[model samples]
Target: MLITVGDDTATFDAFDQSSQVHTTIPCDTSEPGQVLLPHRTLHDVVAKLPDKPITITHMGSAAQFTCGPRTFELPPMTLDDYPPLPDMPPAVGTIDWSDLAAAIREVGAAAGRDDTLPMLTGIKVDSHDGALTLAATDRFRLAHTTLPWDGDDLDMLIPARDILTLARTTWHGDVTIHHDQRRLGFTLGDTRTILRLIDADFPKWRPLIPKDSDTTIRIDRKTMADAVKFTSVLAGDTGQVVLSITSGQVTIASKTAQDGAGEEVIACDTVGNELNIAFTSRYLLDALAGDGTALMTFTQPGRPAMVWPDLPCEEGKVPDADRGHLLMPVRLPG
Candidate 1:
């Protein structure tokens, strides 16, 4: 890591084996020399410091940190050995940082945690019908969403951890995106993030989604979510809840050999065959996470169930298309 101080601005550069970050912040410097410091340790110490401004004095091999009467010196590592980060590609487009962050958070719900399958560990960003869509699956459930993007088409796999860290930031405004054949860069104001694009092919997942359905139902999101929470108390270790549909209502029931049974019936608008379907209790809660009425479509009793939020999302950002979450059912003998 290297820190170069100018008359009014200080440039901080840090890089690991694969990723890099650069930030330029306004500061007052007299000598305007370079200081080498440990990025991780400096981050930890600065995060614990008070909000007041701190002073840093560059020494021969160590930097002195001073705030009021508190002071310390940290010996920095050699900056000459640090490899230069790859250059950021040309600016292709920009996206609303908040919207992109939200989409990544939502679609990441279905990303697999198994590190052995590197391709399944993050969201896949690609163009669908000339629109940007994000999709992720953990084998049991899948989350798909589309967001507003205006630029040349891009297809890349980004690690969930890296992007989520960006999403968690409080920064507001559009993020300038840079991409080429080898590296991807996200720049906002004086800060920038560069990461190597994961070099693995995402699985072919379109066919796993059903083209037709045997049943479809529209119901209040809160109604089903609350019921699942209530009935899952007796669902035991399996945490399975059954949706038994009749004419105009659905019975949500859960039972276990040790514990008794719990049941709750809710009214829903059913447009197809009345069938009994079972899903993991947590999966139902995740699918029904937001407001707005949810539209659930099914193929059969034991197959996958698709959940869609059939209402207007954030204004102007969402397109007029079906964004669905496909959930695989939990199989058990009845």
Candidate 2:
């Protein structure tokens, strides 16, 4: 980590080589020196300090921090030992922070946690037309969302861990993205984040998403989410929950020998034919939590089902290229 202090701003920069996560934050302070400070120690000291203005004065070989009546001195490491920050490459495009953050939260949950398969651990970002599409999958389930953006048609794979961190921490502002062959940069306000792109090729996700479905069900998002949460209690080790749609009702149920069984029925508008499917409760819950749409759509049964906020469309047609979740169904036991 490197800490540089300029006349009007102070910056803290750190990079994790293994995870390829880099973060930079600019502080609103008027300091004019540079120092190398241990991250953990600085965090601990500041956390324990009183909620008052703190003064830090750099000594010859150490720094003194004075908060109210208490004063503490900490030795600083040589700045030369720190690695230099990477330079931002040519700008590929720019996007609103809110849109990028929402997309990350929606799709990042589906990213594979196991590091052995590096490609599945990242999100594939593609820009086309006037929108940016972000997608991720863990084999079992795939999630994606699209938001408006201005950029040339291009694609990049970014580590999910780094993008999620930036999404959660960045302020509400436009994020300028820059990339080259190896590194990707996100600039928000005065803070900039540089992430090393994963070298592996992302899974071919386009074919995995079904273009159309035989069955489509529209239900109240909150009611369905609540039912899933209630039934998940009895889902047990398999963590599987079943959904059966017939007529005007959708039944969410789960059963286990040790935990017994539970079910909740919610009213829904059904189209096509009656269908039944099973899914991992956690994956479904994550998708539900990501979107704020009042109503959600569920399509198909045997294959992956698409779930998205209800779009303003004519009674019988689904919109083309809208933000949504696509979850693969698990085979129910006979």
Candidate 3:
């Protein structure tokens, strides 16, 4: 394979390259044939490259690349070089990096932003009968989404952080995921990453989401998010924020020893019973930050509530996807 650049070119011939001169590094090909370069070396090389066209060929564990002025052969990188990453399934459904990554990032933030729960480090991907479900949970909160796929049958869980990393590094294209019980593998164009799944069983979370609600309110998502954030200063470690909805107004209030107390009110349309609810200020903020439309739906006080972007399917409209925050309420100050 030969790749050309502005003024320099690198070429590799699988048929003619002498086996004796080309050093072959042993790698874990048990999962699948893949290659990874030294993380530091890979980063430095890409950073120094000009904005010229680059060509890469996927030849199992060995890959050939040509960047401007520099032509070098990179041997396969073994998993041992870096910390272990969870292996993703070998085949992913129809791959649209943009959509897939957006979904991943949406869920990843819920798990990544808080390190309090180690299990949240992984994303539970369950594939059964052509449907794929991706879920993440941090004990106190959970985010999940479903997508249809056209591949194999199986259920697997992989590290959420590693999948997020893959999402960030990949551009719009198809990615190949290879999996067996022992490990999960991923191939995106010429890049490949393998990760080791955490052996712990992901909690049975489907039942936790509320299926019905007595109270549903629609409020401006951004406006409400800002209100909660503004009041969280007073919601410190006591981390308590109260949501009181009556008639047509929603009030968010909080109090902390150092920050004293604060409150913000926003307009909303409420239905069913009038109620007051309280939640951890930080948890509410994370749910609001999720990508969605302007309006968020509050189901009921102390019940699972969902948030949605105001206008979906519009330019910059947060996709109309299923995402919500469920917080067990805290006792209010008497």
Residue by residue across 38-85, what tens digits does model 1's lDDT show? 888888887777778789898887899887767778997776766666
Q: Model 2 — which ten-residue stretch has the worst lDDT?
A: 18-27
What's the count of clashing pairs in each model shown?
Answer: 0, 0, 23
Off by over 4 Å in 1: 67-73, 258-261, 311-320
* Residue lDDT tens for model 3, 1-334: 1211222322111111101001122222223323455545555776777787655554655666577776555666553553333334446445556777777776665564444555556787887766677777776667776666777765766777667776776465776667777566655554455666666577787787655455556676678788888888777777788888777888999877777999998887765657778877776776677443344444555555555444333221223555444544566666
- Ranking, lDDT, top scorer first: 1, 2, 3
RMSD of 2: 3.0
Q: What is the TM-score of candidate 2?
A: 0.88
For model 1, state the Cα shift of residue 193 in Å.
1.0
Cα RMSD (Å) per model? 4.1, 3.0, 9.6
The 10-residue segment with the lowest total lDDT in model 3 = 14-23
The prediction achieving the highest lDDT against the true structure is 1
Ranking 1 against 2 by TM-score, winner: 2
Model 1 local distance difference test score:
0.82
Candidate 2 per-residue C-alpha lDDT over 1-334 given as tens digits, one digit per residue, 9 for 90 to 100: 4566666556677676733334444445655787787877887888988998777788868888899988887889887887766677778878777877878988999999889999999999887888788899888888888888777676888889888887787478787888877888877666677788888899898787665555667776767888999999998988899998888888999999899999999877776667789999988887777334533344555677777677653334455656667788887846
lDDT score, residue 204, model 3? 82
What C-alpha lDDT values do all the predictions have?
A: 0.82, 0.77, 0.60
